[model samples]
Target chain A: MDKKKPKKVFVQGAIPPEKIANSVANHQSKTNIGAHSIFLGQVRADEVDGKTVTAIDYTAYEEMAENVFHEIREAAFAKFDITCAHIYHSLGKVNVGELCLFVFTSSAHRRIAIEATNFFVEEIKAKVPVFGKEIFEDETHQWKVNK
Target chain B: MKVTVKYFGLVAEAADKSEEVIELSEVLTASELKKQCLEGLAITDKDSVQIAVNQNLDDAITIKDGDEVALLPPFAGG
Candidate 1:
């Protein structure tokens, strides 16, 4: 069943690790889902020049981003045979080593679930209008570009 | 024609403003307006910036009245 509504995917600050556990726990009743593939994006504490990155402040054109996310989800469902999927991305400031993105896809088989998850991740990186400002230890910042 | 122009990421930083409502006395293509907007800004890589008209990433379309235009820098989402 295709749900016409776009699911909310943005979370303020970091994505709690416990949320992943709770999500897994909530899907227990879906016995038909034989495989669940998960992907977590963590903020890296990268050493740049002499300054170290401390956190990433995320901002987005929310209205457009949500619409693009909806399109991505719809495309993923049309391209794969997945039972269900969930995507979460962090907004605001997320500290280093914290989770920024979580994508979970469940399907009857492992291949479909894994493929769908990959598709979602790739599309999000390329399509979504989310911006990141990498704040350094010295309070200086630089805009992050996805490569 | 009236249009709401939004700036995001580096473009916002360069413009020193997030959004603005501008009245376009003359019609312009998305690319032409983008060039006009970037004229005095400090952005070096014009090719990296993308212009979206009415939230649709189509530069070929001519912008008309009451359109929402966005100047989007490179996407950094995960």
Candidate 2:
């Protein structure tokens, strides 16, 4: 795999479940990978006051976010003995119980793959300039912040 | 000198526009420009906003003509 090339990480809407399966199938030829770790982020229906969140409308500084994602990928590759990694995030509205982020990492051992996946998740939340507007059932909204 | 300022998330909502170009008679630091652009805006926590010059997050950088500046709020990605 071309590990140095930057991959497009943003999808227009919620990440589909079939894409996860496809990702796994695409890696079947890489016999050297003994372990793979995957992480999926789903939107939750959190209640704020009397309103319940129905969906999240995501927006981002696209150019900056893409560059930051690339930097995080480079750092992950340098820090872990991972064979390959893939990351995907949602850009538009994603309904509750839908997937928003998907991270996959493969390595010769289990620990390396797991650690890389966790690292990617943390870095993405803290570094990427992506924003989320939590929309309630009544159409009221509030900005979400990473905690 | 004119700089293109792009707003995102809560900043954009508060500013009521996604992007605008401002003419500056003199050079200003990214932080200064951030304050000037955010002045009188309805955003409650203005300190939470960050500035990026040409896609790099640096408040100390001096703004130049045609530079692309971004006002980013707290990130909520996963």
Candidate 3:
């Protein structure tokens, strides 16, 4: 057991600076992983109708969101040959151009890592109960799925 | 029959929460069921919102007694 095995699913606020390095170490430790693939989603500061996006307010139908996320993880594991997969999504406020989600997959080969990362992200977007409210610099807001 | 109705997204905020039970005297078509829900909430019936029966999407199918119905708001999920 050279590699880390997380018991609890991590759905928390933005991943802190130190946590990112720890996550990398967790997957790469003497585990003979041939490939590690990651997907990072960042908030955009692009102007919508001349109003810049300042931040995003994240919320979820918590019970349903957790169940949906957990189910997606299980399905991905069954569908891919990866040894481990981790998904982190932000709750509460996230600033412009900050990372909101990080999905990591480790496999004995590159193909599985690439495929599993895509599958998990797509399913999580379409199926989960997570919702985001885009707050413009001008103070207006629009609710949208955090795809 | 009394069945559970679940709301979603913005509509859930308007109607408060996502799940609640409503009573009906008899079976109603999916469209008619929408009307009853709005009546309960004192809003005029709007066809724009989607409907689902027993977790399956609306099929213009008539719902029978003891059938579960869910009223879904416009989808804004990503």
Top candidate by lDDT: 2
Residues A18-125, model 2: lDDT tens digits: 999999999999999999999999999999998999999999999999999999999999999999999999999999999999999999999999999999999999
Interface RMSD of each: 0.5, 0.5, 3.5
- Number of backbone-clashing residue pairs for each candidate, in the order shown: 0, 0, 1
Q: Between the candidate structures 1 and 2, which one is better when assessed by DockQ?
A: 2
The model with the greater TM-score, 2 or 3, is 2
Off by over 4 Å in 2: none
- Largest DockQ belongs to which candidate? 2
- Candidate 3 lDDT tens digits, A32-133: 789988888777786777788898777665555566677787788779888788878887788876777888888899999999999988887776656677
Docking class of 1: high
| Model 1 misplacement above 4 A | none
Fraction of the native A-B contacts that model 1 recovers: 0.94
- As a whole number from 0 to 100, the lDDT of residue B34 in candidate 2 is 93
lDDT of 1 by residue, A9-120 (tens): 9999999999999999988999999999999999999888989999999999888999999999999989999999999999999999999999999999999999999999
Residue pairs in steric clash, candidate 3?
A145-B78
